[model samples]
Target: MLIMATKLNKKLLKTLSAVLFSAVVFVGCNDFFGDKTDLSFIDLPEFTNRDIAYVPIQPAWDQFVYPTDICIGFDELLYVVDEATQQIIGLDESGREQGRFSVPGVTSVTQDRRFDLLACGTLDTVSASGDPITLACIYRIRLLNQNGQYGIRYARIVNKIIHPFYSRSNVNAQDLTVRFGKVAIMASDIPSQNNRYYVTRQGQGGSSILGPNDAVLIFSNTDQFETPISVSTSSGIFNNFFQKPSGIATYAVPPQIQASQERHFFYSSVDPANELKVQFIEYIETDFGAEFRPVIFPVGDTSRADGFLFEPNKFSKPSAIAVAGDNTRFLFVVDEEKDSLFQFTRDGFEGVLPPPATGRTKLEKASFGGTGNGLTQFNRPSGVGYYRRIVYVADSGNGRILRFRLTLDFN
Candidate 1:
């Protein structure tokens, strides 16, 4: 009887040890490994659809074949870029056609700090020797009043060529943002081409050629191309690899931060898995010089890629992003594939981590315009812009611009 009891006691001890060991492993996995399988998608607040306010389809203006971008000028006018016509059409706050300007190969437009209109496009100009030179450049235009009529006059052109040896075809300026007299341009490389270009503060004349990657070229206050931030480097803040950068936006960091002098910019790219990825980059003034580096922001207890707040399946081919100027907390992302508009608060991702953390960076609101050519719907919406409390969407398929007023009830 004693021998049998001893064996039973030994077996009980072994079973308890095994259980304790399993518990330790489970705890370690939760604390250290961040067991993503246990995470669930965040339940976001429902978006209530209000009535669509205005749809600008002016018969006086040429039909928009493909409106790629839109921006609000200091004059409170909406500037729409028609890629098919290579022209910019201006409209008043009430959606009345104000005027239009011809800009050849114009892809994007923005207002500078000085209230001058800056446009990025491809230009063909003659050199001193009468040789025709086609270059991708930024044109500064001033809105002038001629006999009570508004007109656009060419201020100057910044020819973006780092070296003469490089073919002009290598430089393609897609999107740009101008702030504090500085312009950050997203210049995409030719598809399947490995050569890249970077701009220096020394002006377009001092631009440099990088090996190959999608890059953001920074133009200094003097209107010179100053630095190139690439996505291929492991050193900067963005350690992830991405290609095919599509859209860009710039926002100002508050003065209280340690790096207040720096400028914050966001660029979007398609990852290898075809996921739309957006990252936040900062132009830091270092001891060496002004450099563009990646930044990480707080997300819950852990941190994540600064501007990368979306999940892998969050967007299907996100084409454009726009941040609200009046309320910086609002961010709008347009998915061209699904014809969906996702709205998120900047603070929504505070405690969430990626990989099945569905609710982590909760989407504050979402609007789905089923694929159609209707007044309320969008067909292949390409770009979005927000100003005041109004949201402007480039309904490219419908050949018109749609404006909507957002009514959020966070309560």
Candidate 2:
């Protein structure tokens, strides 16, 4: 009985000590907080699926004219291509204009890992007859001067890749129809392939002694013409795979230091003839050599449906595409006809997954847009950019740039 009583007494003492400790902690907390009638506290850090909505950061920079495309440069600066003025407008992430440089006939702008700007535009020159002629050309705008000063104002035309002349010394009349619409820069650990880019050419379509006009042509870091990307599959190789490819994006995005060596790229086509608007081509290396393959998802089930990125007719006039090189690896596509922005997972799902608490097993559909000047609406939004968890859109028809952040990302 004495031993049993001693054990019971120890247990009771431990329970009492625990109760006393908890009471002291609670009282101390109350003492620290009770004196303050009003307290300021940050919202809970945990984000539930109910908080999964992309909200706009209002008061957009509305000073642009027909901004056709936007790129978040390797420098972490925002570059907007205003096609109407044929200028590339530079801005900080906060929407403040930094500087602007004009490129004749520039329709889209891309930045390489070297911080140089590659613009798809036209070059005005006199033909053999001394007649003024405009030809599709890719201009390499060196943002740094001989002194190594860097700024948009310091930008100068250091190199030019004219249509047929880029490949051969001679230029022909048939090459006149070729237009370079977009350029996507690639980063490779291999020195020889570093800073390479792919340019989309459109206007003519043919398989001749010269490659097809409507195709994606690769270029070296020196701006020299490389071979076009040939999409090969189990069946065969396709030289003329792209149809007026409107936008091309590589895994190598901005931030010079963290740029990806990934050669895979996402490309979009606005051509009415292209039944499928957006496509992803992955680079695969084999003993035979390196070959590019297109990622194909079965769209067989009609209901194989809304959330899948490859769903039939999912996009209308997809003007541009951007891929996150960060951990998210999210995909962004802006459509002109639909006037909306779509987000997808790297594996091709429509939206981010919902939290377990949401009582939903599917991803929360977050893609949104419409016509108008409202905060979320975009008019002919031709470009989409991603950086630091923010989405920037070039509201072309609205003559402005708008930004958004997912509520779950807010502090």
TM-score of each: 0.60, 0.84
Whose lDDT is greatest here?
A: 2
The whole-model lDDT of each prediction reads 0.52, 0.82
lDDT of 1 by residue, 19-84 (tens): 666755775565676853431343322222322112232222225778877877655677888878
Q: Could you tell me the lDDT of residue 149 within candidate 2?
A: 90
Provide the global lDDT of candidate 2 against the true structure.
0.82
TM-score of 2: 0.84
Tens-digit per-residue lDDT, 1-411, candidate 2: 334434755687687678666755665665575743322342222222334667887678899989998889888788999999999999888778889999999988988888899999998887887777789988899999999899787899998888778667665676678788788888888888899888888877554655678888888998877788789988899887888788888888854365788888889998887777888899999999999999985543323235767877888799899987778888999999999999987878787765555565667668988899988888999888888888989999999999988865765
Residue 291 of model 1, lDDT score: 49
Superposition error at 20 for model 1 (Å): 70
